[model samples]
Target chain A: AQTVTQSQPEMSVQEAETVTLSCTYDTSESDYYLFWYKQPPSRQMILVIRQEAYKQQNATENRFSVNFQKAAKSFSLKISDSQLGDAAMYFCAYRANRDDKIIFGKGTRLHILP
Target chain B: DTAVSQTPKYLVTQMGNDKSIKCEQNLGHDTMYWYKQDSKKFLKIMFSYNNKELIINETVPNRFSPKSPDKAHLNLHINSLELGDSAVYFCASSHSPGLAPDTDTQYFGPGTRLTVL
Candidate 1:
């Protein structure tokens, strides 16, 4: 079984600033995937970014990026130039390669301050 | 166009009542999944189907049933809903397993909020 952990329950960032959400997982599998999802007030789950465990290079999607340390079992999400829309409940997820299921961590509520 | 969609964005019903939430994906993906987000915002996979075949069934209560009529549609039916069942349900889809590169990314739908009174 795999488990994802988000140590922070809540986080706040000033608009236009940057914020990093920490995530760690327990998995013995060599091939897997890590993902960060955002659920806004609308309750819609949106994919922020993903990182492949086999790849050492981090994944960056526009203002969103990840710091993936495979050996440390850590995958953190970084939001640059944080916008009001970035305020949401962020969840860290883990999935084994070719596995149909994904395990999610308890979300971290992100607050954007003006 | 919406890649994934769920019907009845909001559902409110009395306890012991039966309800179903429908999900559809137009992404042409072969795998679909149902996830439950409890009040604490912890999301967990409940069931997964690939091409209408059951792939994964978590240790969820038997009252919670998932049905996939085709590769693009997966629906959830809850019997005798309980207060604890009041939570958000999200549907997602992805490509076939082991395809790597692109198969791992799952696209989610706008969750259906189920409120049991």
Candidate 2:
């Protein structure tokens, strides 16, 4: 069984600043995928970024990037120049390379302060 | 056009009533999934279908049944819904399971909020 853990229940960052959300997962598979999904008040689950286990280089999309440390099983999301629209509940997910199921974490609610 | 869409974005019904939520994907993906998001914001997979074939079925109650008429549509029918069943249900799709980079990358729907009163 695999599990993803998001330590922070809630986070706050000022507009134009940066913030990082921590995520860790336990899995026995060597090759897998990690993802960060954001759900705003509108209740839409949007994919932010994704990282492949075999790739040493992290994944970056616009203002969102991930610090994927395979050895430590840590995948953290970094939001640069956070905007008010970035305020949402972010969830970390994990899926095996050959599996169809995706495991998700509890999620961390991000708040953007003016 | 929406990549993945769910009908009846909001469903409000009384307990013991039966309801169904429909999901369709236009991405032409071979695999589709159903997930439940609880009040605490915990998302969990409930069912999965590959090309209209049942594949992954979690430990969800039997009252919750999923039917895939085709590769592009998956509908969930719940019987005698309870208060605990009130949550946001999400429909997602992705390519078939494989080693491809986009194999397991899921595209989610807007989600249907079900309220049981």
Candidate 3:
């Protein structure tokens, strides 16, 4: 069973600044995937980015990027140039290769300050 | 063009009631999944189906059931729903199990907000 952990309950960042949300997972599988999802007040689940375990390079999507450390099992999301739209409850998720289940972390509430 | 969509964006019902949420995807994906986001914002996978075949059924209660009649549609049916069943349910879709570099990102639907009173 794979478990994702987001130690931070909440984080705040000034607009245009950068913020890093920590995430780590417990998985014995060698091949897997990691993802970051954002849920706003609308209750819509939005995909921020994803990283493949076999790939050494991290994944980047516009202002969002990940620091993926396969050995340490760390997959942290970095939100650069944070904006009001980026303020949402972010979740970390993990899925084993070819497996359908995607386990999510507790969550981290993100606040963007003007 | 929405790749994934779920009907009944909001559902409010009493306890012990029965309800269903329907999901559809136009991405030509073969896999669909059901996820529950509780009040605390903890998202968990409850069920998954691949081409109408049950792939993953987590430790969810028996009252919660998932139905996949075809490749592009998956529905969730809850019988005798309880207060704990109140949560935002999200449906997602991805391409086949293993294809290409596995470019499927699992596009998600807007989600259905279920409130059990």
Judging by TM-score, tell me the better candidate of 2 and 3: 2
- Taking all chains together, the TM-score of candidate 1 against the true structure is 0.96
Models sorted by TM-score, best on top: 2, 1, 3
What is the C-alpha local distance difference test score of each model?
0.93, 0.95, 0.90
True contacts kept of 1: 0.92
Comparing 1 with 3 on lDDT, the higher-scoring candidate is 1
- Candidate 1: residue pairs that collide: none
- Which ranges in model 1 have alpha carbons more than 4 Å from their true place? none
Interface RMSD values, listed in order for every candidate: 0.9, 0.8, 1.4
TM-score of each: 0.96, 0.98, 0.95
lDDT for A52 in candidate 3 is: 83
For candidate 3, lDDT tens digit of each residue in A31-112? 8889998988887888889888989999999999999998899999999999999999998988887577788899999999
Model 3 residue A41 CA deviation in Å: 1.6
Per-residue C-alpha lDDT of model 2 across residues B15-114, encoded as one tens digit per residue: 9999999999999898999999998989999999998998999999999999999999999999999999999999999989663558879999999999
